[model samples]
Each structure stands twice: as C-alpha cells, then as structure tokens.
Target: MGHAADRRPGTRVDRMMTVPAAVSRSDRASATREAILNAAERLFAEEGLFAVSNRRVSEAAGQGNNAAVGYHFGTKTDLVRAIAHRHNGPIERTRARMVAEVGETDDTRAWLACMVRPVTDHLADLGRPTWFARFSVQAMADPGYHRLMAEESLSSSSLRRALHGLQASTPHLTREVGEERREMFRHLVLNVCAVRERELAEGEPTRWPTWDDTATGLIDALYGLMTAPMTPIGTIRR
Candidate 1:
C-alpha cells in the first residue's frame, strides 16, 4: 500500500521520456564496437591474422561503415589489445581470489595452479566454440601484436602477485633460467589451449576431455620444468 502511494502516475512513461537521444546513440555505438571485436577475433583465429584486413572485419561485423574498427579502436594493435583486456577482466578477478587463497605457498604446483586454473575456468565458462586462446596464439606469433598482448598481460596485478609467489618458492632458480622457463611455461599453457580449441573447432578428438583435465596436465608439465635443474649454457660444444 505504501509502495503504491509513493509511485507517481505515468512514472514509467516519464522515465522513458527523460532518456536523451544521446543514450541510444551511445548504445548503438557500443554494440557496433562489440560486433567489430567479435568479428575480428573470429577472423584472426580462423583465417590466420595477417590474411584478414580491417575491411574484412567491418564486413563480417555487419558494419556498413568500413572505418568502424579504426573509429572505435584505433590501430590494429589497439584492437588486439582491447580484445585482450575484455577477456582478462574476469580471468584476473578469479585469479585474484585464487592467489589470496594460495598466499605464498612452498608448493610450486599451487602457484602454477593459481596462474593456470583461472584461465581454464574462464575458457570453460565461455563453453565450446571459443576463439580467444587461438587468437592469442596468433597475436603472440606477430611481433607487433605480441608486444601489445605482453604489455596488456603484464598489467594484471593479480598475475604479478601469483608470479611473485612462484618466484619466492624458487630460491635456486637463476634469473636467466627463470626467464627461459617462464617463456616455456607461457608457450605450453597458451599453445596447448590453442591446440585444444582447434581440436574442438575441427571436431577432432582431443586427448583431454575437459578444460580441468587440460589444466592439470599443464600444471604437471610446468611444475616439472620449473623445478628441473638448470643446465648452464656455456658455448655450444661444436
């Protein structure tokens, strides 16, 4: 009774009338931007990134305006970076919580899992027919876009904390070896995810049945690589 008494007559119509045309324009712009992003991601992943052009992305996105990608996202590098940011938000949130739970453990696998699970969980949540992992592999292959992805990835505070925790546990790990193994870890995780995604996309049977299992396999491999004794690279014995 009190709720009804407080409600003004024709309030809904008045509220609708109050919204400016600018709001609708903004919504349309945002929707167009998202469509462009989705189109670019799928094209880049499926057709090999270099083969696809901005005009292709515009056409695929259903934009009559050929300049949509540039207008919305600036350069191609920026477009790639924007896609990375879009996906990393939720992945970082889950990683932040996982890092808090693990909290400076001696367990190398735990630290790796802190880094690994959030990504797998995010992919799982996105379900089948995902392209971001493959898109990432494509980005990493290109020197220009690799820098963009690398810069965007390093911006995550949660990821930094997780890597720091891993670093703390690895006392015997030298700087050069750490850098080497870190690159290995990166390729292993990302390429494996890319391969699995490709398998799913192509209807080929994958060795692992689920993202969880794939993550576990990576954790094991990464844990082994991270813990393995470093072989000093003197000049190659030729």
Candidate 2:
C-alpha cells in the first residue's frame, strides 16, 4: 500500500498545525526528512516525478528505505510541493526584495523586470533540472497534471497583481492593449523557457539566430505583429 493509505482516512486533520514535542529522536527525524526532500528535488528534476520511484528518492537521499518519502510527506503531491518550495523559495524572497526597492520608483520597466527575471535567471543559471522541466512541460500539456500543479504550488494571482501594477504605472498601456500584449509576451517567454532544455540537448548555441532561422524569425515577426496595433500601424504598414 502507498504511504498515503497508511494515514488515517479523514480522521486527523491539520497535520502541519501540530508541533511535535521536542525530543532527541524527533530532531533526527526532522533532519532525515530534510535530506530526503533535498534528494527528491534533485532526482525529480533530473528524472521527473512520474519517471522516478520513491525508492530511488530514498536511496539518493541516503535513506535506505521507501518509508522516508511517506514519513516526511504523506503523498506524492506533498513531495512535489516540497520540491517547488525549495526551488521557488529563494526566487520569492528575491522578488519581494526587488518589489520593495522598486516600490517608490516611477519605473514600470524595473518593476516588470523584477517580476520576471528572478524565475528565468534561476532556471537559466541552474539549467533546467531535466526531470523537473519535463514534468513541468508535461503538466502544462496535460490537464490533470496542470490542475495538480496549480493546487499544489502554483498561484496566478501574484503574477496578475504584478501585471496590474505595471499597467497602473505605465501611462501608454490601454486596458485592451495591455491585456493582449502582455498575454502574448508571457506566452512567448514561457515558450522560451520550455524550449531551453531541447536547445541544450541539440547543440551548443553560438550567436543569436540570423534572420534566416525560422524559429527566431517567427518569434520576431510575431512580436512585431503583436506590437503593431499598439503604436503607428498605418504609418508602418507601407
């Protein structure tokens, strides 16, 4: 039976609310839990949550048995959350700090950059954890997984709030234009992120694509088309 089955069904509510009485044993248990989470994060990123087994996570983490996953996190969903929390925690802190610094500034660009850069920079620096990135892409493609991710570690409200703040600060953005343009921009950015792993596997990137490169050209063309209506379309049409 899965570790989830072992938990009493609906009887014990509010698990996180209970503070375990401090004891020497519990301290060791907590440390073991952290190690498992760390190992899970690394392995999950490389092998993907679906591809990796709990046993593998246990072994990678130096926990000799599968019970470690269940001992710390009751379900796979909980494990995913622990991984996301670790990955996103620093980015969240950096974003908060950036927001505070940009709070009094009149620049919308800075605010927007602050909002987008942290996540992208982390992914770029770390290189997509193969497993995690695959899982993310798969989740995006599959409705059930998408919902699972949304329920577990995802929140759209904060991103929406950031966009709203940018709209408020930026004078040129009309409601319709901002909504359309921002949506397209975000979609493009996400595509770039999702494709990075594939790009790395194909070969080393040397320079920016020449105009002949279809992918780059297509994106550039779409960017221009999307922005065209926002500015002087008639003058530029000819």
Candidate 3:
C-alpha cells in the first residue's frame, strides 16, 4: 500500500546482509542511517529539497553505497518524514510541559509563548550548529512536502490545545481569518528561527541574547499578529 511496500519485500538493496548475532553490525547500520539523515537534512536545508537526490545524500553521508538512502528509507518523502520524526518527539514533549504550566489561559501572549518556546527550546537543547530550523523552512517552502512536517510530528495534542487557546483569545476570528493568520504565523516562526539558526551556526551574533529570548520576541510578534484589528471598513454600498 505504501511506497516502500510497492517494492518487493526482500530486495537486495532493502535487506540487511549481516547475520543476526552480529550486534555490532546492527550498530553500524544504525550509525549509517543516522549519518544519512544528518546529511540529507543539511542538504535539504542548504540546497533545495528536490534539487538533491538520494545518491547525493548517500555521498554526503559518507555511505559507499549510493543506494544507502533508498535501502534505509525508501523515498524522498519518507526521508523527510524521518527527519521530522527526529525533531518532533522532543518538541512535543517540551510543548506539553509548557502547556501544563500555562493551562487554560485566555492571554494571546501565553498561547503564543506556548507555540514558540517548544521549538526554540528544542534547538537550544541541540546545542550549536543545528540544521532543523533551516531544513524546516525549506521543507515548508515546497507545497508537496510541506504537510509532512505536520503529519509526521507537529500535529500533537499539545499543538491543538495551544491553537485552541489562541483561538479562545480571539472569539470573533472567522475561519478564513484564522487560516490566513495561521499561514502568517507559520511563515514568521519558521523563517525567523531559520535565520537565527543560520546565524548561530555561522558564529554570528543574534538579535537576542539567547534562544529563550528569541522565543520571547516571537511570542510578542505572534500575539500582535493574532490580535491585530482586522478591518475592511464598512460594507460596500450599492
């Protein structure tokens, strides 16, 4: 049914050749997979997603076998999903904890802080030279793979609760308005973080002193955007 399933179950490229008792072989295979993921993520961030191929990812990952990415992950979309999965669990857990602390608040800033901090915190937890934020921006720039990030890990219970809390802060927001604002919010958070991540990676100074401070700035901006006065003036007169 799935893309990988469309191929035969035990193809040479897809199968592991090592014996079962060789736990070290399993360890090496895992390390190879992680290398491929890291290289693919960096390539997807620096270059465009579709611009780079599985072979290129393999080479960048230092895999002698060009089919390494394919063998490990099936398709390009599957690789993207894998990358998102790496980041999503920690992000969701961080958000869930923050949400618990901020419970049932009607404040837009509180909700916005909930939305922004989890991502910043995750990146902070990763230390220097992280690629995920840039990788995320590029992924979202493409229409075909943009939704993978959400479906893979971002659409969690905590995310839904955060959005609902935001919505509660703006009772009169129409569905269309909410959709438009969500798009804007997504662009702001992803791009800003990408810029900051890039700067941090390059040893350049950030506008804010820390990731938490950057998150605080984003919280302010998001709160303003979500609560801004919407207007088209009076209705069109006939």
Clashing pairs for predicted structure model 1, backbone only:
none
Question: Alpha carbon lDDT of residue 211, candidate 1?
Answer: 95
lDDT of 3 by residue, 12-120 (tens): 5335443453678788889999999999999999997979999999999999999999999999999998999889899889889989999877888888888899999
Q: Which one is best on TM-score?
A: 1
After TM-score superposition, the amount by which residue 97's alpha carbon in candidate 2 deviates from its true location, in angstroms, is 2.0
Q: Against the hidden true structure, what lDDT does model 2 obtain?
A: 0.59
Q: Candidate 2 on 1-238: residue-level lDDT in tens?
A: 5455333433453332233434656898888888887777656545556777787888888887777888778777777767666656666666666676666565555556655666555565564343344445554444545566655433533454555566676556577777777656655545555565545545657233421232343345444534454564466643
lDDT of each: 0.88, 0.59, 0.88
True-vs-predicted CA distance for residue 111, candidate 1, Å: 0.6
Off by over 4 Å in 1: 1-20, 235-238
C-alpha TM-scores of all predictions = 0.89, 0.56, 0.87
Residue lDDT tens for model 1, 183-222: 8898899999999998988899998999999999999999
